[model samples]
Target: MSAALPHAPARALNNLVTQGWNQLARVYNSPVLQRVAYQPPQDEIIEQLRIAGIRRIADVGCGTGILASRIQQELAPDLIYGCDASVGMLRQAQARSDQVRWINRQAENLGLDDGAVDAVVSTHAFHFFDHAPALTEFHRILSPGGLLAIVLNNPRSRFARLLQPTMVQGLAYFPPPDEMRTLVEAAGFRITEQRPVRRPIPDQLVPDILTVARRG
Candidate 1:
C-alpha cells in the first residue's frame, strides 16, 4: 500500500553529483519510501534469472544505487550497470562499497555499446524521463529478446491521486498497468507479463507493476 507521502525537505549537496542525487536519491532514505516502493524480494530476483534468463542488467534511473546494490549482492549479473543523469545519485551509487558501477548518464543517451546488456530495470524513476528517448535507449541497450522491467509508482492508486497535486504533474503521463502495457508495446516492446505488487510506503496508496517486456 502506497502511503502517498509528499517529497521531503532539501538535502545538502557538496557538488553537482550531490545535487543530482537530491532529485531522486531522497527516496532511499525517505520515511515515505515504505509505502510507494516495492523493493523486489531477493528471492524474486533469483527467480527472474531462472524464469526469464537475464544475465546482465542495466538499471536506469538507479537512485542511490539502492536496488543495484542488492542486485550485485544477489544476482551478481555477469555485469551490472546503474545509469542516471544525476551526478549526485551516481556518486551515491558508486560510494556503496565500490562493488556497484555507476554511470553519470541520462536515459536518452545510454553511451553504451549497442546490445550491451541482457536486461534493463528501473524502479520508480521513469516518469522523469522523456518516454520516446528513454525507450529508444532501452531498445538500443538490449540484446535480441532482452528483457526490460520498469517498476513505477502508480498514480491511479488512492494515495497517488491524493498526493498528485503536490508530487509533480509529470506523473500524469504514467498511467496504471493496462495502459502502461499499451505504452510499452507502442515503444516496440513485446510485453510478456505485468505483475502487480503491494508495497508499504507511508502516506501513499501503493500498488507497483513490474512490467516484463522483450525486444523484438
Candidate 2:
C-alpha cells in the first residue's frame, strides 16, 4: 500500500480556504453575516487591545478591514497594518480606511521586518492558517513581550462537534484550546489568557475562543 501523504490534506485545505475567501470577499461584510459571524469576537478583540495599550499593531487575516478600521477609530494606535492573503479581501479593506496600511500577504509570510509591531491580532482567522509557520511569523514580527491575540471557533456543543468534520471540509482545521496553547508555546509565546468569548447569540453552538500570548 502507498504511504499516506500527510501534508496533502493540509495543502488541499489551504487551497480551498484561499479560493473560498476570495469568492466570499464581496459579500463577507453583509450586515446579516457581520452580525452573526464577525461582530461579537471583534468586540472582544478590541477590548483586549484596550487592556494591552498597544501602540503599533498588525491585524493578520484582516478581511474587509472591519476590525482594523475599528481599532484605528477607537484605539488610535500609532501604526496599524492590515495583512491578508486574498487580494479580493485586501481590496475591500483598502476602501475602509487609508490610515490602515493594507498589505497582501499570507500569515506565514507577512513580509514585515522583525519586531515591527507591538501587538498582533487575528480574529476568526487562525483556523485557516498553517499553524506552526504562521505562529513563527507572528513571533518574528512582534517586539519582545509583544501580545498576540487569536480568536477562533472552538466548538463545545454536541451539535457543533457533529458538524465540525463537515465544516473542516470547507473551513480547514480548528484546533481545540489546549492544542492551540501548545502550538503557541512551541512557537515561543508565553500563554497569558485563554477564554471563551461570551456568545452574543446564546444559541450559537460554535462559540469563539480567545487565546492571548506574549512573545518571550
Top candidate when judged by lDDT against the true structure = 2
Deviation in angstroms for 109 in model 1?
1.0
lDDT of 2 by residue, 56-112 (tens): 999998988999999999999999999887766777888889898887777888889
Instruction: List clash counts for every candidate, in order.
Output: 19, 0
Model 1 RMSD, rounded to 1 decimal: 7.7
Per-model root-mean-square deviation over C-alphas: 7.7, 7.1
Show the lowest summed lDDT stretch of 10 residues, model 1. 1-10
Instruction: Give the Cα-based TM-score of candidate 2 against the true structure.
Output: 0.88
lDDT of 1 by residue, 1-216 (tens): 012222222222213333545675645656445323445422344456557767688888777777777778876677888777665566567777366667766677777889999888887677666677788889998999888878775667765666575346332256678787887888789998777654344434465567778998
